[model samples]
Target: MADLQDERPDTGHVPVGPGSLGAEDTPAAPVAGALDRAAALLAVHPVADGCNTLVWTLRQSPYHDIDTPDTGVDTDIPRLRAGGVGAQFWSLLPPSAGPHASGAADQVVSDTLDQIDVALALVRRYPDGLCLALSADDLVDARNRGRIASLLGPVSGRTLTDSLSPLRAFHTLGVRILAPGGAQWAREGLTAFGHEVVKEANRLAVLLDLAGCPPVAACRIAGASKAPAVLSNTAAAALNPHPDNVTDEVLLALRAANGLAMVTFDTARTGDSLHAVADHLDHVRAVAGPECVGLGAAFGAEPGVPRPTGLTDPSGYPRLLAELLDRGWPESDLALLTWGNALRVLRDVEFTARAAQHRRTP
Candidate 1:
């Protein structure tokens, strides 16, 4: 919801609402919206005593001047907290680097590293309210202490450099996880679905592991526009046949990285439906093993004001989970598919802490 603008001009591709933001809007507006949304959401789904939920950081960064000398001066964050958003992370956007670049992904990573000074200033500004959070464990400590932990993460993976400096810099900057791929398919080896068909998507995936920025989710997927409304994405499930959906190679990318892959169903992309995502997820579990897969809800945009599909935004997760379960899914298995998978991946990552388990009720 920051100052993000889509490269391609699509109607619903990047929707804007009262809480949404663009570069033109006053910087304060977006941050305030994020805080309001995050706080409202958390209030409804308060984290269990020891559980964790990360409010996307990029959702708040676009408003701040990416070119600011002191990126750490957090004028926007205070507004977010006032609205109830306790945590946020920096967004790694290629477009944010300004037009003209050798490579989209490369530019994003390079520019992101360049902003470390700003991030550091933030750590000092609100040591308790904001800290450079790097692992799952850090999230717990921050939340428990009533402070927001800033888990650093790349919004997408295409920005990584061949030298892995971007990855190293990300770690140094306190980014706890990485998406490793975005809507656009850059020249990286085995590109993510439908954004662009970059042949180099595969090479970069390997680089992520070698550099220690192992991904925590799958190619952030967007389902077919004509897909089924069912919670399980099935239409595009022909093993990533559709460019926007996860192909066999893409699924393998997550498995190889020992990362938890997530299938993000827009539930509103008219071009590609999400039925395939649901179907392929079952297939992924069959092939990639049970632990390496999950789902992400990038459902903030209001397609005709909460009519994108039958369900609403993130608030619709419980209903979606119910549908998946009714289709013969086990609750335990569903838990992982829903959130546990991502939680476990965070646990293994460095600079993060393991979540304390709650005792089972008799």
Candidate 2:
């Protein structure tokens, strides 16, 4: 709320097609004073970011670099605390450059594990600032304690070694979200192995991420109906046909499947400005419903990838919150956008998995 009237981007009425939350339809909350209300809103509702490459965030420090792995100099801790981020789905990305790219299955597996190790090690280095969260409760508890709950997730399904064992192993290593490998897996919408994995994930409560892939047959069956599925850091093609936007058909499928579509902030994928971000969100809300919306903000933490205006860092989150409020978004719905929905989905996935495990225990 830092004099947002001046700093805030002009989020004018974004005209969307049928099924969208039109400007006139958007409802404002009955709260006095914008800044105080925004703070109060966050105090009661924890802000959970759907996607962030925190490992890269750590590298933002001059003392660290990917070529050299040293957890000495720090930035992410104080930064996140200042930003008011409660929980984050920290993506463990395999090396896509240099020697070990995701070319072979073995490389993907090994690199993925290495990424996990680094991410966990970083969390371990800052115990007071960050907590390794494996469940929905863990995330909430961490936030309650004024610590950032860190959840580990693989950035690619290709790292699974084409087997279920590795997938289970990752789960055991505290991965509660997954995106299974293969383009053909989505051909029939869901493949046999994909179905098996989805059932296992459902039974285990591990959330499946579709990345930006359309909510195809597999997404419809596994994500929409069975368990919580996330479309992380993808764009909405209906608004902007950027490489990252998901098609209108996919957005509809996501709604039908009850899946969540997280909007990213990287301008390369989402176009430019916070308004662009808002447009995508409005489109998704209109077509897929607000429950299907979450903020990924793919703030790579490092450089190279340009961030959208008005939302340059973790702290810029309040700007988005304020903008949504200005657009007449209700507090209850705002809570869902910030954290509630993701937590609910995670909890549902966890409960389903635990129940399945309980049934098999006998």
Candidate 3:
């Protein structure tokens, strides 16, 4: 396995300036109207962002309170509300190196549990602003109650320590999604034990995340898992050669498996412009259809890292949606991109879990 440090982006927890939250590329009058329509649309069908590294950010900065308007990271309550986020999957990435690295299985599990504690603690600290969501119904309920539905995802298959016990324990603790591997797993592919993780995840109804998974492993998991796999935070590899980006082959597999590829906003993976971000979305929709497309955004980059123009933080989602609306994307398609598709995948995973529970024991 590769170091977890190399597998994911930096979780640098820098305080964001309040001014940065409102910054955006100015739009023309016609485009401005589209922006209004975009905001209104999101008000009804908000974004279910597939991934955010906020939990890691908070862990790194134990004192930073996300309730503050400017928590220094890309995400905070105000920015999430401004971004029209209804549901967010908080990524719980365990240490890829250090004592917790391979052979220190107990340490890795402890590290993962600590990350989950941070997430659950955040939800508890701000019940009005966030709610722990374990099912598709819970997600919708949180949205209706005006809270961002918080879902937990533990990245890296190694976190399981070659056993199913940790996976079940994490689920019991309210983790709904699992990225069985990160970039390293994409390169090495799943082991026999990894395949068992996928099968058990399906039985538990946990959605498999393929954000850092490459084509071969992605396709293999898609075929092997009963529930739809999700690219929690990725862009189109066809556009950019970023290792974390998804390939056309994987996108096709996602469509076949009724999965979703939630496009990311990381400038390194997508591009530096708002149009560049939209291009990846357009390409994914072109190949996998809109139903397979959703927003992951992947916000919370280290400070000073370049973010896409007009999408500097979580609040910039409206601009991206407006860009799509201006490009002739129908509201219905945008609705699916923002919220419906992710909800549908969660419902499917829950249904699969229920059926699997009847057929197997963990």
**How well does candidate 2 score on lDDT at residue 73?**
24
Candidate 1: tens digits of C-alpha lDDT, residues 108-164: 655566555455565665565565655556655665676655644343455543444
Shift in Å, residue 242, candidate 1: 2.8
Give the winner by lDDT: 3
lDDT of 2 by residue, 75-186 (tens): 2444344345688888876445112233666776776677777778877877787899988899889977877888888445555434677777888887777765343344
- As a TM-score, model 3 comes out at 0.89
**lDDT value, residue 269 of candidate 1:** 26
Better of 2 and 3 by TM-score: 3
- C-alpha TM-scores of all predictions: 0.48, 0.81, 0.89
lDDT of 1: 0.37
Which stretches in model 1 have alpha-carbon errors above 4 Å? Answer: 1-91, 96-132, 142-150, 155-166, 178-240, 267-280, 299-308, 351-362
All candidates in order of lDDT, best leading = 3, 2, 1
Give candidate 3 regions above 4 Å deviation.
1-30, 95-103, 182-189
TM-score of 1: 0.48
TM-score of 2: 0.81
Clash count for each candidate, listed in order shown: 47, 9, 5
